[model samples]
Target: MAEQAYTVVSDSETTGEEKTSSSFPEIAIGIDIGTSQCSVAVWSGSQVELVRNTRNRKLMKSYVTFKDEVPAGGVSDELAHEYDMLSGAAIFNMKRLIGRVDTDPVVHASKSLPFLVETLNIGVRPFIAALVNNMWRSTTPEEVLAIFLVELRAMAEVKLKRPVRNVVLTVPVSFSRFQLTRIERACAMAGLHVLRLMPEPTAVALLYAQQQQQSGHENMGSGSEKIALIFNMGAGYCDVAITATAGGVSQIKALAGSTVGGEDLLQNLMHHLLPNMDDLFSSHGIEEIKRMGLLRVATQNAIHLLSFDESVPIDVDLGNGTKLSKVLTRTELEEVNKEVFEKCEALIKRCLQAAKLEAEDVHDVIIVGGCSYVPKVRNIVMSICKRQELYSGMNPLEAAVRGAALEGAVASGISDPFGNLDLLTIQATPLSIGIQADGGDFVPVIHQNTTTPVRKEQIFTTVHDDQAEALILVYEGDEKAAEHNHLLGYFKIRGIPPAQKGVPEISVCMDIDASNVLRVFAGVIVHGTQRAPMPFMEVRMPTVDDGHGWSAQALHKMYGSTLDLVTVKKIQHRDC
Candidate 1:
């Protein structure tokens, strides 16, 4: 085989020492790290199976309570009441808050939650605190997620009867590179190696691909391709994807997602039932927190009830002599969350448009997520796809995790003669990735929906004569202006010999490996000298943090082309 272009390092395994073993450990388990809940699974010899926690629960609430000095996850330590979960001691929804800046509207919405979320909106990390012993103990979203993952790891280790080290995680399609880095950081903190970070819907597609492959053996159209539209809406996110499957290969055609989900629905219904409810429970006092928790539980129950019944009665005491009584109908609930449903429909339309396919072309419409059980959600998805029924072969709740487990097995080189684990998912880049060039224009090196394990390079020239450095601001989005896109990170390329403007050729290369790790390499060349054998510098991406938007603006205003580059004439190449 040809020499590898780069070295692979598991983010969590960086001790600078290698351990040899006669046999490798079992394949990494698959984990679905959710906004409101989590699950772990593995290939249990015969098939993929969900691993239950100590409580014998397949799904664990994704919350970390810091009441004690040693934090406890909801999986093993059960809270006495739902109020205890929101008593300012537990931190949930970290998935939504991770890698987000104080300026994000989502962060502002999170302030209304039980935990304390403080923001300055100046491109810095938000200050989050949990009530412990009546004192606010500050913590980062990364810390909260690490704590929960530790609990998950321990549970998996005990049940599997081995030390679990590696895992395949499922993430939202809209997560930027910076957000992905935050996830890897959390996994590192938990002492678990990340084998792969699969997109949520793509994982479902993998499971679907396996199912189609098995059934095709007995059907007439065994070799024909199948098109599927996957709609996944959970507590924290909404994502849609279209995929084409044939044999064992799953090709992702298009993807669209948003930060709307069951949490938004719950908040909307809570506000509708009691206007100014957030203001009512703004105080973090014990009584106020309990009251807020009570309202949240009631709202959650009402939303769930509306899924089964047409109307649900809600009566609660605000703990300050305020009695709120109301009966909410399914129609009213749908009306309250009209925007969310509209966004979901818009996402589907966007995906189909991107895939260049009509609704009639979809052979299967698969729905998965906690909110998939909601009749309204199902109805809207069915109406958009114009399908009389949904693909009911997979379980809505466990499909993603099960798919992840199968991925773990396949990625680990596990195989069977029966073809039970013969699967491959050709994931595509969910967003455009490029560097800022040509006076702050977003020049895409790899467009959205491009297959992964991809590399693309572009040549650029210095804007000013004798410029010795160039700043590469990597961004993810399709905006014309770099400022409008999500800034993944930035680095300066140096060691360029002095030359006239546009004389020295600077090549910037972006590589996304199989495990979704991104690396950027830059090199320089002169007309009279040979090309550099190695890149001048290579940096991992998503180094930007919260307030990246402001950071981009500041860089442009302060530098003003002092260290900028413009696109140069390119050579012939194949389409990406």
Candidate 2:
């Protein structure tokens, strides 16, 4: 019953090759690891089928309890009561915590949960722990997720009567390349191979494409390309996507998302219910943790009830003669989470604008995820798209996993007689990839929303006269400042022929394959020739992991622009 250490797989160990043959193809399953819940699905030879646990439930809570010497996940272990999960012995919401630095605001907000989330406010991983046998037991987000995934894999294996290995996972569009690496590591720990990490909204878009194909609406428009907008808001993230579907192909035009969703709304309501909740539970004592758990349960229940009823009564009694009793109106709940709603609205609009489409150009609006049930959320999405009703073809909660299943079949090269498996989801980069140039400004070599399986080259020059070397600081984000973005990695291009400022042409090429793996190529180019003066340095992206933000600062301090490059003409060549 002792905790076991998991071996984190290196990028070299996992290839993006399909492990199947003609006689028998190993079809991958789809997994949607939501902040609050999780689900698994697979292609059942002809159609997509949602895999249920032993309890015959399609959905399972996303949490892991460490009360006993060994840990148990929600996949196989049933909680006696909802309050048991909040008893400081269960760890949840790891989707929001994984790969985030301690300086992140989301990490700071998570401290109020009925568990220990200690942060130093520095650029490093936060300290997370769960109470076990009245002692603080430290653990990492990846470990908890691996334990849960192991259970999921076991359940699928038992149900399907085969070894479940390859999987397609749904992730937030806002997740950085570094964050994705962490997710891959978790999958590796569970002895599963990640086939693809589809964006949540993009996965929804794929499901929309499938539905359109089945309903004979694939060519509804005159141009045969129907534009649809997808909005997905789960517990930890909100994502938006605009796609053009035709003949079962969904080309994602744009993607936008943020780390704001039902969790924020829940926290906002909890704070509104108890104005001094933070002060009341600062100590995190046994009694205080119990009280926080009670209040959280009350607030969560009220939120769910207000989604249907106009008003809900919330009543809870704390041990220290503290009580909360009030009539929570739907309007008041919406008011408390005004910022969250606004953020969602902004994301949808941003995605539309990025896709170069107007509200009227949208052929359909698809809203999915747990937050889609909220009337306020529905109104906001409908208002933004100027639509009367959301598309009712797919279930809000199951769209992502279903889409992932479809993708799994396609990626695994499984063929269907009825052509149901004839589907494709063309993805776009969710964040811009660039290098720090021109006095710490982010110079994007490959802009966000660019179609994937792409390769782009941007020419840069040395900033200093007669500079022999230049440092390439890679980053991922849309931020104008390099330091404000997520640093992917850094490398040096040496042996540059001593040239004057802006005289040398350093061609920096970036390649993003269909699986979203990034590899950066940089070398010095000789003028009047289409070749590099030296061997090109090809390095995999996200070389720097763990406390990358702080590493960026340290890099700046040590070098201090001693090795800098400025952007020249950008030459792009894309393959989609």
Index of the highest-TM-score prediction: 2
* Total residue pair clashes for candidate 2: 0
Candidate 1 per-residue lDDT, tens place, 1-576, comes to 111111133444533222433254467799999999899999988788899987798998988887766777777865543756658888889999998888889988887678788888887789998889999888877888888888888899899887777799999998988888888888877877788888899999999998988877653346588999999999999999999998877899998888999999999988898888778777767777777788888899999998999998999987778777988899999999999999999999999999999999999999999999899899999999998999999999899999899999998888867887878999899999998989879988888988889999888889888888889888998889987789988888886777899887888889999878888888786565665534567888878766787788788888778999888866678575
Residue pairs with clashing backbones, model 2: none
| Each prediction's whole-model lDDT (CA) | 0.85, 0.89
Structure candidate 1, residue pairs in collision: 123-547
Per-model TM against the reference: 0.91, 0.94
Off by over 4 Å in 1: 1-24, 79-81, 218-222, 465-468, 495-505, 528-535, 545-550, 568-576
Q: Which runs in model 2 stand beyond 4 Å of their true positions?
A: 1-22, 217-223, 528-533, 569-576
